[model samples]
Target: MNWDSDELRAAALKLLLLATLRETKVAAPLLAELEELGMVAPGTRKGEFRLLAQQEDKFRRYLSVRWPEFAETEQAFSARPTLISAIALRALRRAPLKLPAGITQLNRKTWSAWAGAHSKSGCATPPPGILLTSDENLRLRPNAGLQIIGEQGGTLDADVCRALFGELIVPERGFSRNWHVTGVLPWLVLTVENIGAYIDITIPPWLLLVHAPGRNTLLATRFIDRLPATVPWVHFGDLDPAGLDIALSMRGPQTGRTPVPWIPHIAFELLETHSLPLSSPWPTQHLPQKLLEHPVLAWLIAHQRWLEHESIVVLSGLVEDVTKLAEMLRER
Candidate 1:
């Protein structure tokens, strides 16, 4: 198999975990860490470590240089895979994890896929529309067919919006009227608490639909730039780290116009009820450098807490909270 760097690294982690299982004096802390990371699969933790009785000198050398701390733990576990040594480590570590009955190849394939899915420890790719808001209209003129007005005061239809306009045009929603370069933006741009909430479209009238799953915040930002700076972009999402990070990403460099949190009290309430763990052993470090500097984001990261927008949907407070948000923004 032509393993890429990412695949090789994934394979190496599996080897490291399996090798650690072989140690006679398995440390309690290490096991706890593994559990916290959700790395151990059910039924697999019960098996005895029968892979390799004797540690290879080359493997030991690799471990010493790669993860010296883990190597010094007095346990015979394999080293954590570095970005470069993953390929070699996988080759060396696999032999020791072979199952009996000569099913090593089958076991290796299964373990590799499972580990690759679960072992990705970086910040997740933020989902579309999760935290961005724009003043894009979702109202469609079914009779309007494809003709959309262009910036040059000419009309371009569905073909142009779909092909050339790209992120400049709203997804799924067609132009009800001709598009123009200059127009007055509404005072509030509201991103739906749930991207799939079709019921949210015209409730408040001023709430603009931001269909981010079909696109993303970066694209939405392009459209939002045309709006007046006084317009406050509001976001409602889960109260988790990812949700806050999404909001941070959507806000971008418009430091003056922070996206208003819609009914954050509801998220906090749900968080209190669920009592969910705020951070993980592998917390996301994916916020952009600019966003990382924001005080709110910095505090969230420091405290390791977030609230999800989904919690509001479950409590049936979406409409009421959104109504409150519109009223609040008007007051601001």
Candidate 2:
């Protein structure tokens, strides 16, 4: 295994953390390099290595000399990497960051530079518990707000309402900030997954349509949380494992409401008439237990077939019957 890997380093750090208190035993294979360095001796039992208390200081010194990153203090052990910690500390000092135009306009590389981390994925996925706002803890300031197709009718805050220009509005601000909706509310909220299907579907007057992009349900969840707990929500997405998980993740914790999976009646019809062969094996292990036992998923797995939401929108001519579909969901 790579000696400098996080897993190896974390194992080494654990040994250092505990060796001072008593003889610490770890799997023999995990510390082969430490054994080679004469820092760990074979334990009393088979397939284990013992780090003696006397060797703890020598081990820490060796790591500090060779790999300083692994020589972290006890407090820093539970914390993020040094670079990430520094960035989070700075961000906490300037909590509730002002981004009038939202995080999308902020440069990724600039964010990385601020974090002192590798410039690729650092900005995209920050440590989840770090950057805390006055009201909520956020990983990254939302780069995009939930795209919506419906009228707020003075329900939305004045500042947010001013940002609306047309039938579809993607707010330029983060949802975790001051954005909120009050007063009158939609009878039902339908979260659509794909952008193509999101734009294509005709929304009924009583229904509020919000785009729930795959795995990025942050904004959508925040928007739903602002609504009353009784406001019913449903989800429509591709008939697949990932889509089902996305729908599951859309459950609003604040409202204590789990959105009903809106597998339109036409979806099953299209699955039978125009279903496509699975291009790749469905990673069912990634699915939650609820989805694993789902009848539709079981049928899809048995048939090795999957259907896209766009197909249901196109082949089923759902745009015309969307109002009736809304009524069906409300009736349920």
Candidate 3:
């Protein structure tokens, strides 16, 4: 089942098209393949085939196992066969540049048109070249992998911006590809993984706070890339494997000069009291090598405990601890 192969995918799609039809002629070799796969049985006449009435569930189950995306398409087709068929036919005729729009251009329909007309949350499986949003709106994937969200302020170079305007929030429009912090560099750059913790944590005049948001690190890494190599970097996130990996991902390639986990001694001390039990088994296989060797991470793994950044932020003396962390990094 090398589903990644283009030839295989095309063959699978052809089989799926046959399955969708109530009564349709199929190529003999294709029918033989279907019969072998338990989807169809040979008919009385030669070169003829028919799907068994009792094998409908089996056929669907087989599709679900072999091609889950096709299974989703099959479900979507049942709801709106005409729309689905039209989209499929349009895709087959010519690949669409965007999504439903490229296929539905003549009708002057938007991608959200499908949602409004058919009550579908989204296209279950987009055609080969098209991309769709959750609400079935056609959208091209952004070149920027992840958008950076954070707050900035303090005495910046006059050229950077006209006025500080107190603590300036990063504009919702996000930074451009060439965007970088220009002016007096912050004493420390702190990347936070969770929005709640990022907002709750106190930001000092000498600190630049960035929202990394889980495993998506493109914008965060780009922001860090623009910073002076001498600027100390640190990450504050969950105490789980994902948090450790995020910190590792943001690390500088220059060996010793990289972002370090901002877990202070207080965090380790509070772990036993504040930490939550692992809801699911820890995925050890995916852990970064550095995390696997980390004494704190190892202890957490052994004890099956994880701490959330929000929990640590809510603790007393957290502000002091962060201040102390900045001071220590400054001294380093």
Worst ten in a row by lDDT for model 3: 136-145
Q: Name the regions of candidate 3 deviating beyond 4 angstroms.
A: 1-88, 92-174, 251-258, 279-299
- Over all chains combined, what TM-score does candidate 2 have? 0.51
The CA-based lDDT of model 3 is what?
0.58
For all candidates in order, the CA lDDT equals 0.44, 0.59, 0.58
RMSD to truth, every model: 16.4, 10.5, 12.7
Which whole-number lDDT from 0 to 100 does residue 312 have in model 3? 77
Error of 1 at 265 (Å): 2.8
lDDT of 1 by residue, 168-239 (tens): 245422222335323334446655445544233333334454543322554455445545666667765655
Model 2 accuracy (lDDT, Cα)? 0.59
Task: Give the winner by lDDT: 1 or 3.
Answer: 3
Tens digits of per-residue lDDT, candidate 3, 1-332, equal 45433335444444454443332332444455667977786666654566766677776666577654666456545554445443453343343344434451212133435422233434344345444422211111111112322354333242222133322344323433235455456777788888788767655556777777786655565556767777778888888867876776665433334577777556676777877788776778866575577666677788888888887777677767778888887887
